[model samples]
Target: MQQNLNYVYPQVFWVDGCTSASASSPSAPPVTPFPPPVPDRRTKPGHNRERRSVGFLVIFMLILLALTGVGLSMFQIFHLEKELAELREVRSAWPEQSMEKEARKAAHLTGNPTQRDLPLEWEPISGHAFTDGIQYHEQGLVVNETGLYFVYSNVLFRGSICSSQMLTHIVYKKNPTLPGSHVLMEDKGINYCTGQKTWARKSYLGALFKLRKMDSLHVNVSKIALVNFEESKTFFGLFKL
Candidate 1:
């Protein structure tokens, strides 16, 4: 074959058999020249198709990223709205809860002896005796709310003649849940007096208990006749914890 001396510039050939060159002669084949010669991508149909596929893939990835970002933003907005709704609910209920707590704090009463029944009755309003949320019923103090409470009682005993019998003072709760009163606290006096002479004794009992609404508390002694019905010496009282 005859040599085609039309080739003027240095020819560049890639591994794929594509060529690249630049010529000063106008008759030279049109070729774009660049350093570090690579495949002549413009001349090959398969190369052109590959470049188009890569461009489309890049565009698809960009669209997918944008959609993902929008979805995340929407999710964050929904979460914030839910938290705000919960905070509003709590804020709306706060005042009522505070009022109830104040009411519970005021549920306290003290009573002095008024009657000599088996379950001693009391005068809740006379002398130092006072009643708030608690009420004095038939023969006991009635609970108006359910909570822990401090129950307390004091009793004084005096007689002209000393007796060998035991002295007992008890504070108990009467509830519908049980058939009988449940003793919450008790005190017993033994050998309190030695001679057959006039003497006086005092018994006090106090404790913490879990009380329920509608429950009643009463004081009991072994002998009602021996009790001194003084307001300062004999009284029952309770306050919420």
Candidate 2:
């Protein structure tokens, strides 16, 4: 039985057979293997990097939007202040030939007080007239009443350039009913003229259509507060006005 153990190679080609059988067949077709699976093309490392960059750009844009809002608010506030000043200047000059009348009024108002019917309290001066306390100063004359207030000035005959030049303290209000001369600013708005020359200043208030008075009793003011701290609300002069 072992006499024919050797295998004879086949002359015809064989298909889909074991390796050993295929080896014995000289005409066996070569086997083809599937290529390694193609790597996932859509989820590459570079693609993930681009997605992260886009997310960061979106966050940066949101931060820039918030900063822009704050800058706009500051700009608006500054413009409003400038416009208000110009309006006051126009309003002050509403009287006839301003310079001549104011000079005459200032001369007569020295050492005199202007009298008003309004109760001694803080109130608007645009349309209202104060008949009470009228005092003169180097800067101008002032009409004061009871209670703390920040009254608006129309225009000064002599406006100061420096803050110190305009600095002044406000004396508290005095009762007209009291017997003694209402203290001419004994407590506040005092400026020493020891080193400098005392400048004479004046103020006048009246309308073009109305007749103005020239009664003298208003004290000439030396304190320059009406011009100083002009930009501040100035409701109180260290007395919580």
Candidate 3:
């Protein structure tokens, strides 16, 4: 066959009549089988949908765990608070606590605190002689049971906070200070407790009854004389012996 002059191609022809393409432009090599899919699932096609770096994934999971832990802790706290409220309600329903609160209030209102031992304002009587003795007096003697006996001595009878005020207070004893008393002398002027005496009233005899029984001064006065209050009067100190 004649050569086709219109196609001056570079293909080599074999002298034996076989035609061959040039090695430089040989047919493409057959494609090797696609590489086996990577063993790691991370590189799969679906992974590209919302890809995350390995470090970022780890960080996100850690953050979720922290949030879950915080939520759980808050739930526990609220649950404990609820339980505590329930317990308080149950306690308030009990009767003994109400009684206890009332008892505490009563004790505080009426009870004297035992913490301190203060001196009592009371004093004891000398004896029944002071309690059941009759009233008597002597002249020029203080008759410490002195009463409004002397008008001039009334100035000395004035009671004052200052001891220098010459104020005199006479304390007396009576056998029976009751109304309708018969205060007889133990032996006339020999009955002078401290001697000097002025006029004294039988009513003042009740002072002895109080001192011996309650150990307290029922008649608190700053003057020495036959002073009267209501039906009571200051008395002469009784002298028995």
Candidate 4:
């Protein structure tokens, strides 16, 4: 005895959607379709270039701001250093000046024509003449405090006739350490006037000097009679610095 067997295969159907129908039946099942894939807007070349440009601009601005901040900080540091240096200088000088405030050496003397001698004499106590922490004796200014001093002198010369002579004026100082007087300043006039005629001339001397205690300063002229004794015209002065 023999037996007979049969096999059946399923069929597929294509439509607008993914639905299937069987060969043995007319009805089919419906399937939901997936939405269309969205276009990739970020993939375009123009949009990529625009994004890159914005990023570069932001980075450049940030770098510029950082550089400006650093420059301002350096300038402030330099300014502070300069101010500190000036303050240090002032503080260093304060002690010396404060100690000598009460006994500061200063003197101003007017000319005295009555005392006609080799080295010209001065009136220490008359008319606009004064001495403080200094001494005037023997036709000279005596230094009592040792330090820097600003020494100044003015002399006026007048004559009824011109002698065409060389006129010399000198300021000198004498101290115990030196054998002779050391000349500090000098002025000379040669052939200033010719023939017999009324003429006048003036010589002025002023400078800073390191003076020592007990140093005596004197003014000498080639001709003492030629010097004018008017208080304002001829004068000598000095002040401690």
Candidate 5:
């Protein structure tokens, strides 16, 4: 009674106690839920705060280093300024020291021995022709300051007839403590001239002597008449070191 339809058609089947096919699809074989996607741990609020704190700490250290460097530079500048001040003070006093040295004590006397006594008298040259210290007195050069001095004297003896007599020349220093003048230098000429015709001789005494304050210095000769009065030929002088 039936002719074959020969037409194929899709089929639908329903399980027992299911309302819809999708809901009843065997519950997707008990799926495992993927562990809630791990919540993106690097983006947590506490971790972000820790990173910010580290950045702030690094910035603070850099600031501290910069301040320390500034302090050191300031200290060096102060030290250099102090040294400069000291150098300036020393320079300011240099000229005064040089001037004190230049204003030293000294004197010069010219001419022959005028007196033959122990403290011989001298003939001083005209003003500006000879120099004398403020301590110099008549007939002698007085020392006002205690120091070393260079003393010198020269004498010329001349005779028409050579007597060959002994000529004595001496420089003496006198002070209040000494009873008599002390001989600073001495020279003796014995049998000096050989011929009788217009004989001449010279005696010179020069040396360094340590002198005290208030001391007096003078030149002496055995015979004052034998001395030459010329300024260039006969002279006595002293200068402080």
Candidate 6:
């Protein structure tokens, strides 16, 4: 029993075999090592505000651009409307102006033929008579306006000896396209008097015609000697419709 023996350490007493100090301390609450400090993932308040501000700015810019576009479009439309209104006003006034101009073109002329059986010549009835629409040349009335017109003429025939010969009166027109003058109206009379005596007759012509510019009108009679040269008895006139 007294033999000398070497003390051998128990395997359970070794630090590697025993529980760790962290597990042994019961009074200190469990030293649970917190997982390596987790990095904060939440965005900062300032960063969030900056992102919101950026989004707001972008939206505001988009809205501003839209408003500007709308305003420009409205302005353009208003301008176009104003121009259209002005054009309409001009169009409305055109007809009245044209009518006034046409009214000023009325002409009343008196026959002034120097020979018989020839085309009747004419002179302005009054100093204020308008003859701009008509041209008097070679015993003809040349039309300068292409429109419907009321044309009138009167002629007085008188003779000391009534031979009862046929009297022919005609209104002739010469068109720019036609080669010759064509009779527009004609009147004939025979046996107007029974015996050899003074005889007098009056012929009048009035009609509406669609005349073209450059057309010419003239009067003709079978006998030039029978015509009375009185201005009041022989006249020609025209007025636009």
C-alpha RMSD between model 2 and the true structure? 20.0
Per-residue accuracy of model 6 over 8-101 as CA lDDT, tens digit each:
4322222433332343344444323334568899999999999999999999999999999999999999999999999999999999999788
Candidate 3 — which residues are off by over 4 angstroms? 1-52, 95-241
Order of candidate numbers by lDDT, starting with the best: 4, 1, 6, 5, 2, 3
Clashing pairs in 4: none
Using TM-score as the yardstick, the better of models 3 and 6 is 6
Query: Candidate 2: TM-score?
Result: 0.25
Alpha-carbon shift of residue 11 in model 3 (angstroms): 34
- Residue-level lDDT of model 1, residues 209-231, one tens digit each, is 88998899988899888898877
Which number leads on lDDT? 4
Instruction: After superposing candidate 2 on the true structure, give the runs of residues whose Cα lies further than 4 Å from its correct spot.
Output: 1-23, 26-29, 44-50, 81-241
Task: Choose 2 or 3, whichever is better by TM-score.
Answer: 2
Clashes of each: 0, 17, 12, 0, 0, 1
Pick the winner on TM-score between candidates 1 and 4: 4
The sequence of per-residue lDDT tens digits that candidate 3 reaches over residues 1-241 is 9876794445554543444556654553432344545676456775664465666898999999999999999999999999999999999887787764443210000111121221101111222112222111211111223222211111112111222222223332232344332322111111212333342312112112212221111122333231232111222222211
Q: Which ten residues in a row are the worst by lDDT in model 2?
A: 231-240
Could you tell me which 10 consecutive residues in candidate 4 have the lowest summed lDDT? Answer: 23-32
Off by over 4 Å in 4: 1-99
Q: Which parts of model 5 are misplaced by more than 4 Å?
A: 1-94, 112-119, 125-129, 132-134
lDDT of candidates 1 onward, in order: 0.81, 0.35, 0.32, 0.88, 0.77, 0.77
TM-scores across all candidates? 0.56, 0.25, 0.20, 0.58, 0.57, 0.56
Per TM-score, the best of the predicted structures is 4
Off by over 4 Å in 1: 1-101, 105-114
* Tens digit per residue, CA lDDT, model 5, 77-191: 9999999999999999999988877767787777734555544455556532355453557578888888889999888877788785789999998998769889999999998
Candidate 3 Cα deviation (angstroms), residue 33: 38
Model 1 poorest ten-residue lDDT run: 105-114
